[model samples]
Target: MTEPSVPHAPTAAFIGASWLALVAGAATYLIGLFNAEMALNEKGYYLTLLMYGLFSAVSLQKSVRDRAESISVSGLYFGLCWLSLLLALLLLLIGLWNANLALSEKGFYGMAYLLSLFSSVAVQKNVRDVSLVRQAAPAK
Candidate 1:
C-alpha cells in the first residue's frame, strides 16, 4: 500500500499576533499581581496600556509577513490593536496623575512598558511546515 501525501497549510499571521498579545497581557497582569500595592494606581494601569500599545503598534505592525492574506486587513487589525492600547494607557496615566502618585513610582512603571512591544515583534511571523520543493535530477 502507498502512503498518503500530506497537504500544506497556509500560515495565519493572526495566530502569531494573538500569541504575542496574549503573552504581553499575561506578563503585565502577572507583574501587577506580584506588586499589587505598588501597582495600585493609574500609573500601573497606564503602564499596562502602554505595553499593550507597544505590542500592537511597534511589534504586530512591524512584522513583515508574506501570508495568503490581504495587507489592508492586516494593517487595520494592527492599527486597531495599537490604538486601543494607546487610549487605555492615556486614561490610566491621567487617573494616576490625578491621584497624586510619586514621580519615582511612575518612572518605574516605564521599565516594563516595552514588554508587550518586544513580545509583539519577537513572536514568529512565519511558521515552518513541510513543503514539496521540486529537485532536479542528477546528470546521468
Candidate 2:
C-alpha cells in the first residue's frame, strides 16, 4: 500500500514574500483609492471590488486545495467559488473599462488589483500548508 504524502511547511523566504506581496499590493491599491480624484461612490466601488476579489481568490484556492486533498467540498460550493472569482474579475474589468481615468491610472489599478488577488492566493496556500504541517507534526 502506498503511504499518504506528508505536508511540507513553506520556506521562510516564500512565506515572507507571499505576505509582503499581499501587503504591498493591497496597501498600494488602497492608497491609490485614497488619493484618487474620483467621487466617494466611485472610490467605494473600487474598494468593494478589491475586497470581493481578495475573498473570492482565497476561497477558490481553499476549495481547490481541499478537493486535491480528497476533502469533501460540495460541487455547488466549488462551482460558486469559481463563479465568484470570475465575477470579481469581470466586474473589475467592466469598471475599469468604463471609467474616466487616464490610461496610465487605469493600468495602475488593474495591475495592483491583479497583484493583490494573486498574492492572496499564494498567502492562503502558505497558510494552509503551514497549518497542515503543524497538525501532522508529532507532539513534543
Off by over 4 Å in 1: 1-29, 38-79, 124-140
Candidate 2 local lDDT, 1-140, one digit each (tens): 33335677899999999999999999999999999999999999999999999999999999998877777889999999999999999999999999999999999999999999999999999988888788889999
Displacement of the residue 86 alpha carbon in candidate 1, Å:
2.4
Error of 1 at 19 (Å): 12
Clashing pairs in 1: none
Query: Residue-wise lDDT of candidate 1 within 50-79, one digit each (tens)?
Result: 555655544444433322233333666666
Deviation in angstroms for 62 in model 1?
7.1
Highest TM-score scorer:
2
Could you tell me every candidate's TM-score relative to the true structure? 0.42, 0.95
Model 1 TM-score, 2 decimals: 0.42
Query: Which ten residues in a row are the worst by lDDT in model 1?
Result: 128-137
